[model samples]
Target chain A: MFDWLQHFADWLIFTVFNIDAGTKLGTALNFFVYDTIKIMILLFVIVFIMGIVNTYFPIEQLKNYLNKKKLYGLEYVFSAIFGAITPFCSCSSVPLFIGFVQGGIPLGVTFSFLITSPLVNEVAIAMFLGMFGLKATLIYAFSGILLGTIGGWLLGKMNLEPLLSDWVKEILKLKMQQTSYQKEQQTFYQRLPEITRAATDIVKGVLLYVIIGIAIGAIMHGYVPENFFNQYLGGGQWWTVPLAVILAVPMYANAAGIVPVIQVFVAKGVPLGTAIAFMMATVGLSIPEATLLKKVMSLKLITLFFAVVTICIIISGYVFNLLL
Target chain B: MSKVIKVLGTGCPKCKAMTQVVTDVISKHNIDATVEKVEDIIEIMKYNVMTTPALLVDDTICIKGRVPSQDEVFTFLSNNE
Candidate 1:
């Protein structure tokens, strides 16, 4: 992938410090610089493209499509696939979920979208590709999407719409208000400044987190003994998977911020499966997201949702650790 | 004279509430202005706004990260106008 970045970092380190770049400290320093620069460039370029796509992808069409679907497996698949692309925030997805429910989308289909949208997004893809290489990146993306699809399917089969909170049911009865917008046509020529501006905005938002994550990673890279975690973490161990999932569920962060830290974890000999499971849990599930989901779902249903995702993630972590 | 008021957001609830506030202020004053909701993340960034529920009056950033009251929105409009 970005082998050039390593060479560049090596040159910079050797030229500045007059030290052998292959030494332990130099290698860690080079890793930090290479990854930070790579991720920064990736975030800017990918986010810019995503912004443009978001502008052209009409929300109305997606809603209409979800509303019209009647088949079970096909609808779930379509919803999960669409959800995989639509980037989501902890709070933003709630209102959109409300709209979906109000539009008469089935419980399971909507859940599929909500669960998959945040977990399997493009930003994560770019981060994984840059940090974990192609093979691992593909495995991560595939497992994430598959986990969402299967989890949603199983939940839907349970027919638990009655478990929705009373307030959610009441809102469904009321006519959802649609906000109309005056058309604003923009050409590709006009989008140049907009793309740069968006890239800058996104960088500004995540820059601090990214720096902190990378800093922590650099420290770990320098200080941790190689394969220091063999006894504590391995596929052969049963507790490692659940331990990773439990540790990851409470702390939430964007993929851009967390991937740097995960890179260090993998370097520190965290099992590939456990590290990825942690990534999915931290990025996909969070307290704020749970609080928002609570507004529309009963305590029981919320518990069920969390439980399902946790189990799936733990299973993935253990399976990958063994296979890889 | 007319003005263009842009609400920069990702179409979240806070963004929607701010849009409603701006809409109400415009109607109450009967102001001769065009209100546009910039829901596209890319479009919203043209103003260098990092946070949502941002109010931009005629290309100048007014309020960001929170919804201003209708009275506050009125002041923003009147001052800009």
Candidate 2:
């Protein structure tokens, strides 16, 4: 499907630049150009389509329904799926978190939504498909949902309601009614400009990270020895998964930027599970997100949330390694 | 009719942009309105708004989750007035 892009990269690198195809610089440049173009195309299409879908999506209605119904344990799955589809930014996490909780959604269920949201979304899916192929993308998506479900379910069971901040508790006691904003309905064509602008803004926001990520990936693909990661991060060592997750906790990057680097890690000798776990930890459990959560949650709750999620990610990493 | 317009956001760039747009619109129209930027999460939560950059005209939400274009802002202000 993307043969033209690959050919273009080839022609540009070898024919136009007059570089030997076999040389490291030539190979790296080719990989960089091809992957960058392919990922950008995928990103734009996916984001644009999602923007359209979101325009018509009754998010307010859905949140109301989620609040009223008891979906048994399936709420976790529902939240996970919702998390996956929604194009969320970490900047909006606090408001979204408070909204869910105030809407009477169970705390664990809200956590499920929060956990899967950052880990698997349109940008992450697009990059995964472009770099890792369909099979890997499916596995990654499935694992992300599973992690959110189980992690959220467990957290819900912890009876941590007492850990909420006084401000949140006071708000909860008030039981504020969810405000239903009347959105003006417009035809697709009328909404097109706004949707297009939104899609463009999203692309612009992540472009720099994407470039930096792909550059690193290109260098690794061309210059790094094939067995370098395998020598250390390979061989199914238990510590590697935990270590990867631990190392990733402090580093923060959106999925678009991190996916390329993760791809290179897999391309080299690093275990797929460890690479994925690292990506999850980096995206899902961030210091900034924790700080944001501090508004509604006490220090104790924040610590517990991070600890629980870290353990869940590490476990999922091992499971993926064992199964795949 | 002097109105109070509150722009609720957590200080993200988009939020800042939304505030800027509202400010520009208010000045351009010479509308009788005061624009208040709400950056506090607890205060924003009182409005029960899940999305940031929500434009509230006299405490009634006109838009949320995205910044309104200048014309949209003008329409909102004129309608409320």
Off by over 4 Å in 1: A175-181, B1-81
Q: Which candidate wins on DockQ?
A: 2
TM-score of 1: 0.79
Candidate 2: tens digits of C-alpha lDDT, residues A1-324:
999999999999999999999999999999999999999999999999877766565666768888898888999998988888877566677888878887789999989988998888778778888888889888888988998898899999998889999988888889686655656644567668877887888888889999999999999899999888888888667799989988887667555787888888888888888888887888888888888899889999998888988999999889888877
**Residue-wise C-alpha lDDT for candidate 2, range B1-81, written one tens digit per residue:** 798889999898778888988999989889899999999998898898887778988777888777667877887889833
Candidate 1 structure quality by residue, lDDT tens digits, A1-324: 578888888888887777686687786777778888988888777777766665455555787887886775877777877777665444456656766777788787788887887787766776787778888888987888778887888788888889987866766676654433324334666556644665576677777777777777777887788777775774367888788888877667555677777887787778788888988888777787787677678999999988887888888887888888
Interface RMSD of 1: 11.9
lDDT of 2 at B72: 78
What DockQ, between 0 and 1, does each candidate earn? Answer: 0.09, 0.59
Clashes of each: 0, 0
TM-score of each: 0.79, 0.94
